[model samples]
Target chain A: MNRHLLAALGLGLIAGPALAADGIGAGLLKSQCIGCHAIAKPENTSLDRLWERKGPDLYYAGSKFNKPWLEKWLQNPVRIRPAGELYARHVKGGTKEDVVDESGMAPHPKLPKADAEAVAEALMALVAPAELVSKGAFKGEKVSMAMGGMFFGKLRGCGACHMAKPGFGGASGAELYTAGERLQGDYIYSYIKNPQQFDPRIWMPTLNLAEPDLQRLTGYILQLGATEAK
Target chain B: MMTNSRQLASTFSLAGLALASCFMLPANAAAADEQYAKAARNYDTYCAQCHGINRNGRGINSRDMSVQPRDHTDAKGMGDIPENEILKVIKEGGLAVNKSVLMPAWGNVMSDTEIREMAAYLRHVCNCGSGK
Candidate 1:
């Protein structure tokens, strides 16, 4: 009878924190995140509606972000994109140059460690479509920076939008230096395959990249982001 | 003896012309080469991404873009485009001429003088004189 009592006590102790953590996460999502973030997958992908978004869509956070990075980032959030979410809206100055208006972009709210972890837990549950992310899009193919830059910079002109490094590339899109650590390899491949499927009104064109080139570009971007994360 | 003197004068004149050409030819050729080199450098930096390094509209970005970048090497196509039209495209971007907005305007980045130089450079690349 004593042994049975002790076993029940042990099981309760082990499961208590786990269950409480999930409950806490759910509560936080309701109170803190829903205001600016879209916890549920948004059906509207129109540019006009997209312009109204304050923060990045988190419906695919599970597929898109690394849990560790997301948790860490939530604790001390910083600017990710140089141009911010919508470059067109945030830009100022003369029409000829169109410089980024730093004043227009608001910083993300910081969270405490416990809250960050709980929030990350809630976010990580939001996975993108299975067919796109589950498929073996990226097979961990090795790509050299030199070769990747040939396709990305010299050939594709990605430098005109996304920055490869600080002050090196264009600011129309998000910086790619931290992509490796922040994003999953599969998500990168899937996003590149067809950005329109996820974001219909995005300025980014679908390259319809084939094998080897697709894998190579994914590997290159991952390598680039990894280098910066370190 | 008189015929020999006249022949000598003709030979000396021909020799002088050849010597003068030797000095002048390289100088002219060097200047022309320098202009072409500068034009190529500019084109590579700004236009090569969509227009291609070969100037053939087969740039790396060409795969995904719906509208094809204008091919600079096609004499027929380039010949139809006037010098002013080329200048407008460079200074105001493709949208200025009812073309693709994908082509960013270089007016802020490049000066009016630079835009004119680019037009001349395009002409050189096409090997076609100004359409007008």
Candidate 2:
């Protein structure tokens, strides 16, 4: 009996660490997120596979999301992409029915406070390579609304797809009116610099803007959040 | 199994003949209508968000924009505009024509054939060169 008890204790010791590492959050992620989100590391960066995905890849969620913002978003979900991930699939013939239904996207399920916190914790653990988040990608520089607005609307033509204000701008991408509040500056800078890194088949073309222009554009997006607060 | 295989072969032949007819046929009213329909569908996919389904310039995104989207149905305004200019705008965006920059360059996204088709649809809508 003593030998059996000792063997059981040894097995418990062996399994405890593994269970602790992959706790409730990991289980929840498997159950709730894997259906839509790509929680596992992507095996290939093929555009065809990227297009096949139902939702945005969250493999690099730790690098992409601000924890607090993610937590809040999980609790009270809202539509980000006006045309959904694949705009072609969402926006059909320019009809009243298509516009009203927003057929591309289904509403994200809202999580309870505890579940949201747990999910946020799990997501924050999902990190990409260090090279993806290089130093100086985001310097937290400030940009005035006038200068940023000019670049967004005229110089760069970002306004074509993204809205700087409600009901304004382009209708295909994530609404930029709330970007500053919604996104992290680092994620925004990195994403705009090279969207292919996050999503290979995304409709957003690489602008190939100069470094200064890139900084200015990121600053403009960050400033939009503060501007809306007023 | 042999009978079923024969049936499948006959079905495939029928489908192949139908497809071949579509290509060999001369331009007809139905073909023109199909082309127009395709162009209209393309416009809805790419342009209708800002340009509106009816080409009236009051799209879902129009209210939020600083400059209003151009009303394509405005025959007088569109009449003066050249076909080349319309094609240029579709290819290069409003910035190409010194118009609003809110229009994005679609050259990267659309093929030349698609752009031409869009221009044709635009002309059809405005009744340009139809002599009223």
Candidate 3:
């Protein structure tokens, strides 16, 4: 059994979208999205990497994107990336434009309204919420924050990449010591789980942490800006 | 007549041994060839991305990446990572072992057989083994 299969495996495998929706939405995603995005399978070749020119992977969209944002984006595509895809101009050498135009993103021509709703629901269902909550979804507590702070620097080594304050941590990844005050929890959670899923070809390590560890880490980091102390 | 029967039995046994060897030889060759091909392909698609086309950490994506992708061609660093550790990292993912979350787990993506093949390919490309 995988490490996720702990004895307290509440809700178990049925924890995902299968129990929430009739699956009509997931069925549509399978037809529409699977060509580019992978919910589970990994491979040397990915259609998203090839066809999109450059973009984020969507294997864990269920866990990464917020429900409302996902629904909105699906219905109306937006330009989230300022630089487009990083490797958009890799083949053409250093010359030529590199970014994908923001105006280029358009709504699916044939996605029915019903299917969109279903797809959104299905995708949202992909994340295991309870597991996230258990880890460290702290409503607010000084002790939790303090403990989280210590864990973040020494144990997890989050300081290695991120640019936290002088005593906070290092600068290997995004600055997240104060992520608690600035970014939303879901956004932080998704980014922490798989940075590249939101932004393709990102360099953050695909950390193999337990669900609880991830939630705790996310929770602790999210509270960084809210601590009210320097 | 007794001598003739004994000779016939011996010949049959020899023939059976020959047929078995014939089957085993081709099967062994084909299996080895298939693994080699898979290893080559896995290296081209997966390892080459971070390690560059030449098994060095100079791929296009490696430039802007926060942590400079490890130079697999660096004999010194490659020596530190054992084949078993590399296999574990590849299969379980970089973050699982508190290494880097950037390296995703291929367990969901590739099969065990594919992972084994990829492991063999890494050894072939790096050529570091237990030492640099």
Give TM-scores of chain A for all candidates.
Answer: 0.86, 0.85, 0.46
Candidate 2 lDDT tens digits, A1-230: 99999999999998886575387777788899888889867787554565467788888788777789888999999878776765545644344322533744678899999889889888887776776655458888889889999998877878867878776667767888778877777788888877756655355656666888889999999899779634
Which is the leading candidate under TM-score? 2
Off by over 4 Å in 2: A1-26, A38-55, A81-105, A125-135, A153-172, A193-208, B1-42, B73-80, B111-117, B120-132
lDDT for model 1, please.
0.75
Q: Which ranges of candidate 3 are over 4 A from the true structure?
A: A1-64, A78-213, A220-230, B1-33, B40-49, B65-67, B73-119, B127-132
RMSD of each: 19.2, 10.9, 14.2
Task: In model 1, state the lDDT of residue B58.
Answer: 56
Residues B37-116, model 1: lDDT tens digits: 75565565456555765687755445445467788999999999877888888877776797766675666545688778
Model 3's CAPRI class?
incorrect
Kindly report which residue pairs in candidate 1 clash with one another. A155-B60
Candidate 1 lDDT over residue span A29-99, tens digit each? 87988888787777776545666888777878889899999899999998887767765556544332335
Which ranking of candidates, highest TM-score first? Answer: 2, 1, 3
Compared with the true structure, what per-residue lDDT tens digits does model 2 show for residues B30-117?
Answer: 6766879867766765677677766887665565577788888888888888888888888887878988777766665567998888
Give candidate 3's whole-model lDDT.
0.56
TM-score for predicted model 3 compared with the true structure: 0.42
Worst 10 residues of 1 chain A by lDDT: A89-98
Candidate with best DockQ: 2
What is the TM-score of each predicted model, taking all chains together? 0.60, 0.66, 0.42
Candidate 1 interface RMSD value = 12.6
lDDT accuracy of residue B24 in candidate 2: 67
